[model samples]
Target: MLNLNRNSHVPWISAFLLIISYSIANGVYLTIERVTYYPIFKSDFTSILLTIIAASFMTFYNYKRYVYLIPLSLLSFLLTSITPLILLLPIAYELRKISSIVGISLLITSSSMLSWVFLRLIANVNTYFSLPLMLITAGVPVLIPIVWFIGIFFLFMPNKKGNKDSISLNPLIPFILTLLVSLLPYLPYINPYKFPETVDFKYYYSWLLHPQFDGWFFYTRPFYLILLYLLSLIFKPYPVAFYEFVFLSVFYVYSGYKLASALDRSIASLAALLASVSPMLITFLYSGLEANLFSISLMFLSMYYLIKKEKITLAIILSLLSMLSHIYAWAQISTAIILYYVFRFMVSKIKPSKYEVIYLSSSLPFIFTGLLLIFMGIFPVPMSLANYNDLIYQIAVGSWGSSNMLLFFIITMLGNRFMKNLLGFIYAISVLGTLVIQPATNLIIDLPLFIPAAYALRYIRKDIAILLIINLVLWGIYMSINSVPKIH
Candidate 1:
């Protein structure tokens, strides 16, 4: 497992790091603000409540099963905070250094590494002298983003060896491949000089960068906005390109790999390899379609659990997450799951079993949410005939460009193949419908096309598939690098 000795008190990560940090900062800040004027909280209700809940959970969880514990981020915070005190240097100087590009990178990386190490060091806390230290560097506003990165990093490195209830990360091939594949596109966009490349992207960067979450932006897509809001705090001084790398890194590892495993477990790696390099995937990853990206990520993950496995509860929860991400994608995901049920029923000529009925019932809330959105006249993207042909072009060829015509031809040829698995067929059909439902969402071909394309690849001769991988990877890299024309 991730435990160091299985007796440590500091849960894998310093569970209370975020809440405790916020409590320290916001508690003091709010008290001053209240004396100045009462606009928000009378006390630190927000942070306190979260802190209490997190503290309670950690307390209860560590009671019976103490995983190797280390105050992963806490130790780094000690180094960041206490060192200056010991050396008799002012902490403000250290804080200034800590916020630099190198400093921020170190904090982020240290949190991730220490989280892994802390989970590893879960046991033998007495040996380390267990203080359950969850301190921050007094006034660092970087805690939220640090915690966010550490949360996602846990997925990047899962505990392969676990107890009976522990997750099975078997067949690590797809998981690892998908992580690399999903990460490939955003590398080129990370240049400091490059702007967000689109007007919408610029607006989103601004909207989330602000401390206040004003506007209907959050109302429409709370999931993506909250994530972007946290990221905005981290990458505010930098270009939006940096934001894309972090956002996509956390999102697509689950989406891409799970989508592959959902379709066909044996060929999951090949599926991820194919899906990650899709022209559409590469294109939209840079298009500033935050809600779409997050929705599709959840959609793919939900699909993974439901398709090959029978994790109804998880599928339902993730489907709801997708709904919160984007109504259109949720609509597609809900219907796809329901239709998969119908497909099974049709083939068997029998009614759905009890749990299957429960699964179907999960779509009711989504339907209501979708209808509520319509009645409220809060359409996310205005439906128009204008984006139809453009959507098709984007799905097949990715953006308007003559350079990828060869890639276009190949994707189309491969996309035409029929999926062998029924769920794969249903998902492909569901995503195919997105081409017409909304213009922008059609750009999300990675979740839909990744698996079927991989299935089609299986039909090819081994030598040809190898050639196709190389060819696709080169084009994928090319597409990624040239995705958004760099603004000087």
Candidate 2:
């Protein structure tokens, strides 16, 4: 049994020291790995001295507060070496019992680090596993965070009969906070040639120089290209990238706020923050992949209006715009529309409203375009040969990969039963589609997961929701650090 005091500083201090020790060990390991040739004393002495100091302070200050830290610190310093963060997970789990805030924070940090390390390990392993084993290995990182999150919820935030009044806060605060936190990790990478390595930018740049008006432009999203062209007029490439980054960030936060507002104002803010700090979203933003960001922002915004049954026209317009932004967006928006109507028919037992009809009808043009492409035999344009092993490797990375779709389905089914039956149907289909198709870049396809998650957050305690948000931020940070820059 451990101390379970929310107000106590002892557990917080212990957790902080554990993080510090892990950081020191990781820094030393990275230094050793980076240096081609390292002097023994320079590497060994520095790491050993720092590790001892960190471990000694941790032991002296609050050894009784968390006895597990003793072995964790020693093993982190001596055994795990480069992967000390994984050793802090048990400490985080224990801390949750004492202080939910510190406990969940450390839990997210450790879990995210473990995900990164595991993904790297999978990539390095030359041997292959059977499909089932590969699926399990890929799912480990994605599933661990969800499992731990559920464990924390049940352990600390047991559901009670009476519901507490939701907290009231101006939505702008979250929007601003999200913008600040979302910008922090990518601040250093902002420049005129920001993410110049991405091949997609070439198309935008070329479209800016010469406007294309032919029907052949179907493959290229005209609206996104036009926006890039306009931005290019006033700013250089880097500034254009920054402007798009800011634009997309604002919308991302706004979408979260809109979706969350359906349940509670405070929850809306937290959802916005979580969505803004999402690792998948952040990774795309930093890479200057504005097409997907724009598409996703519109998707969320449309979903918000669709859920509230307000401003149906605006939702329809936004849905269309999202479709025009990217082919991926088109697929996601189309799927969402089909799902929304099907869910309504099967679960709600109510006829579709006129507004819903309008929304469904609006998708026709995009659908027709897709069909026309296929009929003309111009769809699925041939590309360089794709390696199935590499595709499996990407899925195994657990960074918003295919495994997440399955996890999201489980989460949907467990969190809200009605929602599980409703959104769960859509999620199941999406996951199956992802498995069969396994598109090269599939993050945008996972947008549907956030809908059920937002509903789940509404029902949970506020503190628990905040814990989830913190976890999202930590996950985003890890992805940003480990992400490979796009090659042109």
Candidate 3:
């Protein structure tokens, strides 16, 4: 449907070539490492060869039908590294249509592969200047795939007339009403002592009640802890919990408002309504999980600035703050920021100005704090976490019961006809990647689903809103019935 010129295809072709170059380079390095340094694999070679043959056939079949080949190939890669060659199938397809959706998907896949490589490189490095080497090595894997994907996405994007009032919102009445309604479900479970008594509260509360700055504090969410500590100073435990609840709820509503405004006022109202009643958000609020609340709110706000305002400095600062609130937010916020800049640079030729640089530079203290936490062995590595299968199951059907919402969000996103549709696809793919690659922090994927769902509401507002209200009421009742016992 989009009008395009002959030269538009060049960028996709170039991206395909870049991906090929990286693949070849990685293949060579892996081969040399296996052959010269690592032990010679006799039996494993048979498995690897068989995997290659199987993956090649699968890739060919999927490519012929114009279906996505990366997921199966990615699964195979997990089992045997040789299957990474299947990545070529999707890249080859992108050369034909050059859809931003496809480009974002490839970006996710390549980024995952690069992150794996970086982790391996860091693990293997054992020298006097390993720290500097590790830092430098970290940038390469991220930058290469990022630039390639950004190029394809930007080059092929449709050149439409810009809407000057895109960022404007309608009256605040509807948003306020939505916020009030969203607070209704939590009203029944508002026992401050009981609400904050859930998991992780005790650990965080301990840090708040008795402040200790020296040595390595394994809990790196200092902002959250400090806020809780300040709240504790003025109020009893129950009131402190109540105030925290109100603060997070307001921020969540505000984020939805801003995000929706970027598209339209009606859409913004719908987004705020959804956020107020979202089962996942409500659950976290009831449980007093400041990290999850703050991270999701800040992530949403960061995306608003990046996409709507083109305020790179605010985006970066909020993103870093979100990362500080919870390490789990790093992947979600980072991916969104990267895509935002890629779109901005491509569509508007906008780059970060000196003011943006000055603002971002302000985050150095927080970055240093994170680095210190890492140095003191405060943060746990992926290997130290729960097994992948367990984490995957938890994400799929555990406390974060977002599987149904994720399914609905994906269906709505795919059905919508908008530029933001690509973003929905990106988030959907990231959700899958989070499940398979880094299941430890799976809930972060919920943040991106909001945008598409908000957009979809514009089409089927009445029907969807009715269904959402029914579901919200049922979920609220469920939460109230199964509420945690209050702490003495």
Which candidate leads the pack in TM-score? 2
Write candidate 1's Cα lDDT for 232-338 as tens digits.
56766245434564456445654776676665566566655655566445545544465766787887787677655578889888878788777765765576666
lDDT of 3 at 447: 54
Q: Rank the candidates by TM-score, best first.
A: 2, 1, 3
Number of backbone collisions per candidate, in order? 11, 1, 0
lDDT per residue, candidate 2, 23-118, as tens digits? Answer: 333331111111111111123344444444444444454566544555555553355343234434544554433355554554554464555444
Task: List runs of model 1 lying over 4 Å from the truth.
Answer: 1-200, 211-215, 231-241, 246-250, 343-348, 384-446, 484-488
lDDT of 1: 0.46
Query: TM-score of model 2 relative to the true fold?
Result: 0.59
> What RMSD, rounded to one decimal, does every model reach?
24.3, 11.1, 16.5
**Cα-based lDDT for every prediction:** 0.46, 0.49, 0.46
In candidate 2, what residue range of length 10 has the lowest lDDT sum?
29-38
* Better candidate number, 2 or 3, judged by lDDT: 2
Q: Which stretches of candidate 3 lie over 4 Å from their true place?
A: 1-198, 214-219, 310-317, 339-378, 381-392, 400-407, 410-412, 415-429, 435-446, 472-477, 484-488
For model 3, what is the alpha-carbon lDDT of residue 172? Answer: 66
TM-score between model 3 and native: 0.52
Instruction: Name the top lDDT candidate.
Output: 2
